[model samples]
Structures are given as structure tokens and as C-alpha cells.
Target: MKKSVTILFAFIISQFQAQPGNYYQQSAKYKMNIDVDAEKFTYQGEQTLEYTNNSPDELKVVYFHLYWNAFKPNSMMDQRVSGQGKNGDSRLQKDGVSRLASIPKNEEGSQNIHWIKQNGKELKFEIQETIMKVYLAESIKPNSTTTFTMDWDAVIPQQIRRSGRNNREGVDMTMTQWYPKIAEYDYDGWATFDYIGREFHAPFADFEVAIKINKDYVIGAGGILENPQGVKGYESKPLLSIDKNNKVTWRWTAKNILDFAWSADKDYKVKSFDVPEGPKVFLVYQQNNKTKAWEEAQPYVTKYFQIMNSHFGKYIYPTYTFIQGGDGGMEYGMCTMILGEAQNIKDLMGLMAHEGAHSWYQQMLATNESMRPWMDEGFTSYAEGYTMHQLFPEDLPNPFIKTLDSYRAFIKKGIEEPAVWLGDHHDNGSAYTYASYVKGELYLVQLGYIMGEQKLAEVLKQYYDQWSMRHPSDRDFLHIAQKVSGMDLKWFHNYWINTTKTIDYGIKDIKYDTKSTTIILINKGQVPMPIDFSVMTTDKKIITYQIPLNMTHTWKDKDMYGDFSTMPYWPWTQKEYTLTIPYTKSQLYVLGIDFSQRIADINMSDNFIEVK
Candidate 1:
């Protein structure tokens, strides 16, 4: 009996680590053919899915995401937006009211699955709003593969959300989540979060898609154009003649992408910029004055790819399409849909940098966003901040000061949910948005402050190389950081992510003599963080002092600023700590805590003391 129990325990542990090379995720291959009706604003699709079960559990049922169903009147997304009152999404509101509540039936979006078959046999299935569960006739054994064939018809919603038609920008269609997408199956089982107009998560797969549309419409999609010569926008490659019905079929293919998206319009002008050792950046938009900004942004976008590739991991795809479609910017597999109209080239470049950064954080890393949104949006925001700083260099010591301020604002509101809260189920939309985008982004910045910026950069590159194709959790990243920085970061994760604690450190007291000055630092807030203390002398030279948290048990090796003298670790139990510097009291002009503004200290006014 003892031996049997031990064997069972071993078996369970083995099943948990079943993925290939200890970083396993399920793989999918999709072959889809879509027929679009430009006049009616609808499409018919046929999909063949080949899914491999990399998990150890046997599959009795498979799920697919019917995301368009969320756009209907009184749907979950509509109701959520309506319930949020004025604090809800501005795009979903029209005339100071919820526009989704009044959408016309013809304009409403939906995917109606006609039939689903497993292998050669039809299967029993049920549609649960945004999720469709299909029961398999034969259970898929562990380490096996299954094929699912589906036929569906979908209506293009009248440009209300991510997947829509005739956006405000006048783009004819934005084809995102327009298909019966397969839901991700991981160690957490099926991820079938209802589409509440917040976040999306999916398994990475190879896509082969053929879109048939009116010959007049030009196409921009996520993947590579398999037959660019047959498409209109891809010039000077000659276009193939339209079919008998005045429609043309455009073929596209992408490998190891999370999802497939495409947009079509009658007036899109295509411009391509080639980046050395990176993807050919394609900017597609309607010809207008706004397009000039996009044109001016060509060199900046090229530089973005170059910096991101060298700093982060390399971008695998050879092409990336940036289309002027949708309410705002949204990232797809190898492309991004961004609103074209910008005030200037700089604003457009900022938007493009944020969305382009998603190509690495969201598209490549592919974290389970609904579960851990910060890993997706937060990491991307961090990259966006860095990219912007590099693109438009300012004299500010810390370029990520805005991100840190945003986090402080969220904390001051006193409505912040734990960063670990489910992406769609937060108490309010502000909590979800701020927690995911702002706090998540600040996590990296503050971490860089804690563990030296140079070390953080190394860890980020190593993380991207190891976990690009695999979804990584907060703990996974912390583990990587711990290994790289030789520091214990478990307390950092628990305090920052799992709780709503804030960090506040102030100068409690100061004493000085002829040869040395002593400053008392107090941790008044619930959260704890490493301190980067600095002192400015009357001679205009800055003397730096570093304090490592007792929890870390290790100090950051190097920082972006000049080297600093090490101080004792601040213990969490002890509220106040004293540090005595070699500078005399009369020689110091100002004593500041975190003068770089990297730490998210709630009460900033008390962080600095003026020498009298």
C-alpha cells in the first residue's frame, strides 16, 4: 500500500510536467476558407482544425470561442458596459448611452455554427454564449491528436468592437475573432472566459486561411500573403482577374501564431518598409492627410523593430501588417490594427510602438491573459515605455515615471483589486484596466529599480528566449529573475501581485555631525521595497546609497546610475532604519529617497528633505 501511494504521487507529478522540454503547450493547425459578402456585411466560413493533446488528461469534450456572440444586444459585454455607467468604455457608448443596447439586428455580430464533426462523425455540442462545448464520440487518449471540422456563418457587427465592419475610420471590415476559434486547453484545463469586452487568450497555432471578397477591396491581414501577386494592394506584382462573380480569393499563411486576423477596404494604400534582420513592416491605410503621419513614421517603426528585436527576443515572422482598422489599436498574430488619424507623427509612433510591442508580449509570449493579464499588458506597457524613451530621448532620469505615477493614482483611488484578479471579473472596469495595463507595466519598472536595470535587462532577454512560445506565469518569471539576479523575489510577487498593499517610505528623522549624517527611513505603507537613496552635496556632486530588502538576501549587482555604497537590508518587521553617510550635515543640500522616481512611493512629498 505504501509503494502504491508513492507511485500515485510520482504519476501525478509527472502529469503536471507533461509538456515538451518542461515548457509544453498544446499545438494547433488551422485551415479555413471564408467567403465574404460586401453588400450584406456577413461571411460564411469552413474550418478544419487539427489539435494535438499535449496535456496528460484525456479529452472528452473540446471547446471553441464564439467571440462575436458577445456583441449582440444585452449580451454579457453589452450588459457589463452598460452597468459600468460613465466609467465604462467610451467606444461602446454613443449619445452618452450604451450603443450595444441599440444595435440593429442586421448590424449585430454573431457566429452561427451550422454543424460540427469529429473525424467523420457528427458530434453533440452546446453553445454557451461565448463558448461552445462539443462532446467527442471517442475520447482522445493522452498524447494523441484530434481533428474537428466546422461550418459557420457570421455577420459583421456594425463597427462596435474589435471584430466589426465599417469602422469609424471607414475601413470596410476588421476581421478579428470572426471565426469559431478553438479555446486553449492547458494545465488549468479549458480557458473559456465569456467575452466581456476585456481580454482574450488563445493557444498558438499555424494558420492557413483563404479569404474571398470583392475584387475592388484590398486586404491586410496578420499572416504572410501566400499569393501576393493575386491581391490588389500588393503592387507592382500584377493582380489576378476576378472570378465569375466579381470576387477574388486571397491566400495567407502564418506559422506558430496565436490567432489570425485580417482587414479589407476599397481604398487602402499599401506601403512597406524593410528592417534589416527584422520583418518587413507594412503600413496599410486609406489615402488621406492622416496617412502622412504614417508615412513619416516609417523610419521610426523600422527603428522600433530593430530595438525590440535586439533588446527582447527576435521577431520570428518575416512580415508584420499595421492596418488602419478598428476603434483603436489591437494586436493580432503578426499584425496590429491601429486608428490612423493622429494629431502628429509622434503620437502615431507612440501608438504604433505600444501595439508593436504587443507582438512580443502578447503574440509571442502568449500568456493566459484572462488569468494573468499583467504578464500580457503590463509587460507590453513596460516595453512601450522603454521604446518610447529610446525613440524620443528626454533629459528625465527615469522615462517610466508616467507608468509609476499611474500606479500611484490607482492606489490613491482605493478601488484597486489584486493584480491577480481575473481580467474580466474585476469589481470595476477601472480596476481591470489599471491593474492590467498600469500596475502590470510598473511591475517591471519597479523591479528594475529593485534589481539593477542592467540585471533586469539580462533577465528579460533570457525570459523571452526561454518562454516566447510558451505561456509563462508570474512565478515562472520570478523564478527566472531569482536565478539571474541571485535574489529571493518570492516576497516581491506575494506583496505586489497577490495583495493590494502599497509602498510608502518617508524621511522620518535626520541627524548630522561634523563628519557624518544619519537619516532615518520609515516604511509606513503595507508593502516593502528596496530603497535607492541619494544625497546632493553643496559641491553639486550626488552621493548614492543603496538599501537591499532583507527578504531579497542579495543586492542588485549594478545599476544604470553610477555605483553606490551598500547599506544594510531593511527588515519587513522593522518599520524604521537608519543610514549614516560620510558627508557632514553642512555640506549636504538635499537628502532624497529614490531621487530617480522609479519607486512608486505613495507620499512623494516627504521623500526629500531640504537642508537648512
Candidate 2:
């Protein structure tokens, strides 16, 4: 009986360590054929969607995102940007006027769907700017597969946002979100969001795409190019083309990806190099004097992939491209669109590191950006900081000082919103960035403070390993963290993500007798956390102590800085913690709280005291 009970306990522990299997996310398969007129800045497309309904409930309706429609004059995305006024995204504004509204009507973006069919039966559909809602001809049954086919064409708008033609950097076409992408439907039902201005979310799928365009242009995309011999720099020699219009049809295929985006340029110079133990790194940009930095950025970006592959889990994609395009830098599935005219290597490589790190959190982990952007953007930002820490030398106490700096600056305004707010529903753009990127990165650093830094590292590896292809929400990640740390972190998640509560722990008072020194730690902020403080004695010995939160039910076995003694648990209800050190007043030099600066304490003035 004893052996049987032990086996049962081991089984329970193994279940928590393994990937739990109830998230039945629907999957999609895409087959698209696109023909483009480079001069007209337009394209015609035929798309076939093979969708599987994995849910228990039958689907009555479905939707797709015509993302390019957001670039129209009076579209929902334009209105959302125009409404921000003074706080609008600077990229979408020029001297406070909406660039989207100023686009020429002929040059404006439009997607006119010719027809749609469900399983060879005609289905009714309505286009409301960027979102397409389709009334199903027949209710899709649970655990069933269905096919939807559509024919559409669009006049690509002049560059205003992520997907457009002829961006500010002189790239010919930054083609992203230029297709009729099907909306993701998971346990939360239809994630049919209006194109308001952030990123997107989609399920993993296979793509077989063929783009026909003028032979003069060079193309780069997320998928592996099938017939690349004739395309510019993709293969060693040119292959014969049978078309009479001086056009080449670039065939490409990608397996198990979320989205497909591509770019075409008349002067695009493509360089393909293999990262040792990483993906085949491709640097696609227009070579000019201004793009000298693009060449220098290769080694730095190569090292980033190696570091991420070693530090995090292996990068799932076989090829990763750093293509030159977009307003600034935007991350896609296996490639990133970055502006190419930068003159310096540091700035250019810095941009690539941040966007490239998105492969892990944004593309692979595949969180819904609209709902749980913190898990995507914030996690990517953390990976970026680590990459920069490796690629360049930062003379700081820790790698997260920039995030801490941003967090410190943003908290002072008191205009911060709860991170739980949806990506597009922020009070302003700056607030969204702070809440998503800054606060999100700070979440990991603070977790290192709560859970040991070693444990946080363990959590990252396990998270990437288990949730790479799965659409993990905040709860799913927290579950992995709890399993790794052996602690309940709901209180930590509640305060940091669910509320605008700040953290400010301080050394309130200190006193000493002949045998021991008494120190009082006070929690001035609403959010309470496990404390790691240090004391430098007059005897010149630096001593540290860690006080675990009562809710944690366990303490960190090691510390990042040095060795520390485990003190009693600080109950969340208690505002003050008294610590006694076996040192006299004459032997103490100074007492400080969280001297390593890992915690995001809003105030630092009272965290230290000179023990005279």
C-alpha cells in the first residue's frame, strides 16, 4: 500500500510537469494564389481555407480579418488613431494630422470580396471595413472539418502602418496582413476584433502560397520559397520562366505557422547565411551606403539566435529573415520587417534583436496579442534585454536596468492602467506600451525576486518547451511557474497584472543592542512581496536575508547575489517585518532593502539607512 501511494504521488507530480491537454484550439490550413501588378500597386487573390472545428460546441458563424482595410480614410483603425489626438501614435500622425485620413482615395486600401462558399455551397457575407462576418450556410458540427473559399482583390495603400506599399524608407512594398486572414476561435469563442492598431492573433496552420509578380522585383517572405532559382539571390542560378508578361510566380510553403507575410522590392539584395545550431539566417535589404549597417548587423543578430536557442528552448522555425520594410520594426511569424536606412550597426542590430526575440514569445508561444499582450510583448521585451545583454556590453548592475528605468519613470505619472486591459483598449498609446512592454518585462524580473533567479530561468525553459505551439494564456504560464517554483503565485499575479497597485518596501527603523541588531521593514505600497535585503557592517561583512511571503509556502534555496539566510515568512496582512541580526550597533555600517534593485519598488528613498 505504501509503494502504491508513492507511485500515485509520483503520477500526480508528473502530470503537473507535463503539458495539460484540455485547450482544444482550432487549426487552419491555407492555400492562396496571388497575382500582383507592381506598377498599379494592387493584387488579386484566391484563397482556400481548410478549417477544423475542434470544440465541443457547434459553430454557427465565423469571421476573417481584412487587415489592410484599416488603412482606409474613415476606417475603425483610422478613427481609433485619430481619436487619440495628442496621444496618437506618432507614426500614424505627422504634426498631429492623421496620415491614414490623408491617403488618396485611388491609393487608399480596399478589399472587395467577390464571392464566398462553404463546402461548395454559397454563403452570405458582409464586409464592415476590416472585419468580415460570414453567416454559415450550415452549422459546422463539433469535431468536423470544413472548407471555405473566397476570391478577393485590393489596391495596396501608400505606407501608413505595418502593411502598405512604398514605406518611408523607400522599400517598394511591405506586404503584411495583406490577406483575408481567418480570425482565431478557441475556448473564448470568436476572437473577431476590429483592426484598431495593435498586433494580431491566429492559430497554427500550414500555408501553400504562390505570388505572381514582375520578374524585376525580389521577394522575401515568412515561408520557404519553393521555386527560388529565378528569384533574386534566393538560389545560385536563374531558372527559365515560361510566362510572356516578364513575371515570375514565387511558390512558397510553410508548415505549422500562425501567419504569412512578405515583401517585394525592385532592388532587394538577399543574403543567406546559416547560424551555427540556429536557423538559416537571411538578411534581405536594399544595399546602399546607408545600409552598410545591415552587413555589420549579421554577426550580432547571429549571436542572438545562438543565445536564445541555448538560453530558451530551440527556435521551432527552420528559417528566420530580417527583411527591410515596415514603419519601424514589426515581428511576424518567421521574419521581421525593419526599416532599412539606418546608418549605424548598433541601432540596426538593436532593432533586430528586439524583433527577433518575438519569435519565441509572439510566434512560437502564440498568445493572443489583443487579450494577453503582456505574455507576448512583455516576454519578448525580456528576451530582447537578455539578447542585448549578450550582444553588447551594458555597464549596469543587472540586465533589466532599462526596464526598471522605464517602470520607474512611468509609475510617477500615476496614469498607468491595469495590465489586464486588452491591448487596444488602453487609455493611450504610451500607457499601452508601458503596461505591455515595461510592466511585462518587470513581471519576470520581479518573479526572479520572488522565485529565485535560477528558478525563473527554469520557468522560461519549461515554458518554451511546453507551450511553444500551444496558445498559452496568462493562467497557463502561471501554472507552469507554480509547478516550477512550488509556490502559489495568484496574489503576485493579482496585484501586478489585475491592478495598478505599486510596490514600495522600505527600511523604516533600525536599532541595536550589544548582542543583536533589530531592523523594521515597512511596506509603504499596496503590493507586498518577498523581501531580500542586505546589511554592510562596520566589520566589512555584507550580509543578506530573504523573507519569503507566507503565501509562497516555500523559500528560495539560493539567491542571485550571494548566500542569504531564510527568515520567517512575512504574512501578506502584516505591514511590517522585524528582523534581528547577530551584530551590534558598533559593527553595523548601513542597512538597505533590496539592494540589488531587482524589485520594482516605486520609491527608493526610504529603502536605505546609515547606521551610525
Candidate 3:
């Protein structure tokens, strides 16, 4: 019987290891074809994709994104356009042209052609969708390869957001997202969506892109240059071709990348540094407006790159560029577009640190930004806070230590809102950004406190390794957290992500018996954050206990499980907790719940109890 049980256990372990969702077990591959022209600052290209369907079921359709459409007039994205100002009118008045309104509407299209093989005969299929589609492509066999061709065109928008055309005198025009690209389709089906001034999730693929530009222009893209010997303005030369009009053509090939972007300029100042055992760091900023501050900022940005690479996984790309453009700091694969202005050294470092960290969440992990914006944006925001706390400890705000102050400030002004709202559905224009960015970071900080920092970091690394270049829902995150913490956290999730409840627990009553001392603690708020309770005896000895509760998703009662023999660790909840101290009635004591105010307890009036 023992021998049979051992054999069965081995079989089950092997089966578990063979599951398709195990990203670490299998290698994901992609290939792309891109061609660009610098004269008109636009791109027309074909992407040949070969995806390995590792899943169990057959996939019938694929999705592609036309993100430039978000900049169109009368679009949903057009409603929230503004410039640097406190009020909407000030932003409008400062810049007569609404950035969204300035996007060129005439140049965006994509078509997918399917390959068919029947009875030794080869055929092709074509289908096109304005936004996205479910086409009848050949069923991709399990653990096999299916190849398709996509042709697209993108007219570069005038530098608005991160991806666009930037025309500078004596400088080469920098163009990005100058072509339509296919979106990702997996267990969740099509993931095509318009750009909504938020995060981005792209499908992983290899890229072989060639651009034609003037001979004087120098181009940089997501990958290394294949053939630099080709003459300007020709298509039939070699691997990839360029055209005349002094336009330089660039051909790029990338492997295991989700998206592609490139920049070009005749006068671009290119600088490179080797990162030990990692990708090379490149700085591509124009020298026209460069200053001493700018020169000093580059090293700071590079330091952040080192910090992020060490904390997260290795930087996978061969090179990363810090290009100057757009309104502020934004991230592209293997490159970041940053605005060239900062008030002080701290401000400059902060911007660089935040943007560089995006490479981990937005680029490396590549979570879908449309549906689960919180995963990329919120997670990155949390990382930003963490990085800031580590790098600029004196200047940055400590979310864990100042949770109460944050809650009080938000509540006292009556600006408190449910943190569960959709990323694009907030009433005010900036509210969504603030909540998703700041509040989301706070949530992670609080989670770190609940489940020790080391455990939280482990879970984060696990999450990135598992879901990189894949789509994971909100539930997936909670599931991973539960597995990492070894505790069921459904109640925590429901309260934190699904409701607007606040946390307010305090001492309700105190009494002493001749044999022992007893105190009653009451939860005063609807929200149920884990609690910490501390009490002092008349002799000045302190005691602490942690109380676990069921308030968010469950209503069951059970004894809390945690070591309470320590002096400073206590947990309380929405319900009352009764504590019996091992002391006599002659002793007097003072009791406090969440004495450090780290849990953001909304009310403190009931936190203290006196016993005589």
C-alpha cells in the first residue's frame, strides 16, 4: 500500500507540472515585420506572427489595437483633454489646441491575412475589423505553431502623449506607434481597446522592422540594426529597404517582445553605457535645450535603472533609451520618453525613478492596461512609492507610517470615495488618476504591513514571473496573494477592492475581575482592515494581540490565530475583541488599539480605555 501511494503521488506531481498556464515551463516566441519612412513621419508595415497555442482549447480569433483612434475628435478620449493647470479652464486657456483634438484622423488601418493549407495546396485568407474582430482562422493545434500576416499603416500624430512625431529644426523627426499592430488574444479572447490615457498591455512577438529615411537621419528602435550598409531610398537592396528624399530607412528585429516603437533624428545625441550582466543603457536626448541639470539627471536616471533591475528581474532588452519628449515621463519598451524639465534634483530623480520603474510592470510583465488597469498602473504606483521610499527616504512620504494622516485628510475634506471605481469612470477628470495612482499604492503598502514585507516581495516576483506578457484578472492577483501568504484573504479583497468602507476600531469598555482583568474593544467602521491592539498594566508592563475577523465577504466567527505573547503586535477588526490580562484588580492600566496609527483608523476617540 505504501509503494502504490508513492507512485500515485509522483504521477500527480508530474501532471501538475505539465499544466499550460505554467509560463516558466514553456518558452513563448513571436516575430514581427516593420518598415518606416522619416520624410512623412509615418510607417507602413507587415507583421508575420507565429503564436504557440499552449492552451487546451482551440482559438478562433485574434485582436489588434488602433490606439491612435483615441486622439480623434468627438471620441471618448477627447472628453478629458487638458494641459498643465489646476482647473479645466486654465488648462484650456493655456493651450488653445487640445492635444487630443490635434491627432490626425486620416491615417489608421489594419488587415489580417490567414494562411490555409489543404491537400498539399496553399491558400490565403483576409479579414479586417475597424476596432477588433473574431475571424475564422485555422484552428491552431495544441503545442503547435500558427502563422498569420498583418498589414497596417499609422500616420504619426504630432507629439501628444508618449508616441508621436516630434519635428525639430536640424534634428531628425522622432516617430513612434506609426503603424497599426495586432492586439493580444488568449484565455480571455480579444483584448483590443482604444487608448484612454492609462496603462498598456501588448502581445509578445519578435520584430523585424526596416525604415527608410534620409541619409543624414539616425534612427533608433526597439531592437538592434540589422543592415546599416543599405543605401537610402531603396526597397530591393537586401533584408530591409529605405526610400529617397534624404530619408533613412531602419530595419529592426526583436524576439519575445510584445510591442515595437522607434525614434529618429539627424541631430540626436546618442550615448551608451554597459550594465554589468544586463542590457546596455542608452540616453538619447536633444542637446539644444540641455543644461547642467539635464546632464546631472542622466546619472540619477541610470542609478534608478540599476535599482529596478536588481529588485525585479534582469533587464531583458539589449539596450534601453531615455528619450526626451511628450508632456512628462512615459515608458516605451526598451526606452522611456521623458520631458526635460525639473524644479530640483529631488524632483528630477523622482520622475526618473517612477518612469524607469515602469519597465518592470508595464514593459517586462506587460499586463493588459484596458480592463485591468490596476494591475499595471496601480502596481507600478506601488512600486514607485517603494522605490521612492528606498531612494529618497528623507523626502518621500512613508505610506505605512502616515496612513492615519492620509485617511484623515481625505475624510475631513469630504473627498473620500470608493476605491473600487473603474479607472475611466471617476466623476472628476483627475480623480481617477489620483485614486488609481496614489490610493492603489497605499493599498499595496498596507498589504505589505499585513503580510510581512519579505512575503509581499516574494509574491510580487512570483506574479511577474507567472503573468509576464499575459493577462491576469483581479481575482488572479488575490489568488496569488492567498497562496503566498498561506491565508485566505477573500474578506480583505472584498473590503479593499469592492467597497468604500473605512476602518475605525476602538476600546468600547473596560472592567477588571478579582482573578483577571478584562477589556472590550469595538469596531466602529464598516471597513475591515486587520487590526493591532496594545494594552499596558498598572505596573507598566505592555501586552499586544492580533485579532483576525470575518467582515468583508464572510460572517463566520473563529478564534484569531497569531502569537500574542509579544508586546507590540495586536490585531482587531469590525467586531469587538475581549482581552483578559493576567493581572490583579489592584493594578490600573491604559489600553490603545492601533496606537501607531498605521492602519488608517478613521476614528480615535474610542481607541483608549482606562481601568481601575
- Indicate which candidate wins on TM-score: 1
Q: Report the lDDT tens digits of candidate 2 across residue range 1-612.
A: 999999999998867644435568788999999999999999999999999998777999999998888887888878888888767788887766788888998888888899999999989999877899999999989889999999999889888888898888789999998989889988787888888888799888999999999988899888798888866568778774748888889998998888898999999998988888889988999999989998787688788888999887899788999999999999987899999888688788778988988889888899999998888889888888888887888778689987897788888887898889999899677888988988888899889888888999999999988888888888889999999999889999999999999999988888778899888999989998999888898877889998989988978888667789899899989999999989888888888888788889888889888876
By lDDT: ranked, best first: 1, 2, 3
Alpha-carbon runs more than 4 Å astray in model 3: 1-39, 79-144, 167-176, 225-244, 288-291, 395-422, 425-427, 465-470, 506-521, 534-574, 578-597, 602-612
In Å, residue 68's CA in model 2 sits off its true spot by 1.2
- Stretches of candidate 2 exceeding 4 Å from the true structure: 1-21, 240-242, 538-540, 610-612
Candidate 2's TM-score reads: 0.94
Write down the TM-score for model 3. Answer: 0.74
lDDT of 1 by residue, 255-362 (tens): 999999999999999989899999988888998986678878878888999899999889989899899999898999999999999988889988899999998998
Q: Each candidate's TM vs. the true structure? A: 0.96, 0.94, 0.74
Tens digit per residue, CA lDDT, model 3, 531-554: 556667777866666554433222
lDDT score at residue 303, model 1, on the 0-100 scale = 90
What lDDT does the true structure give each of the candidates? 0.87, 0.87, 0.58
Task: Order the numbered candidates by TM-score, best leading.
Answer: 1, 2, 3
- Worst ten-residue run, lDDT, model 1? 16-25
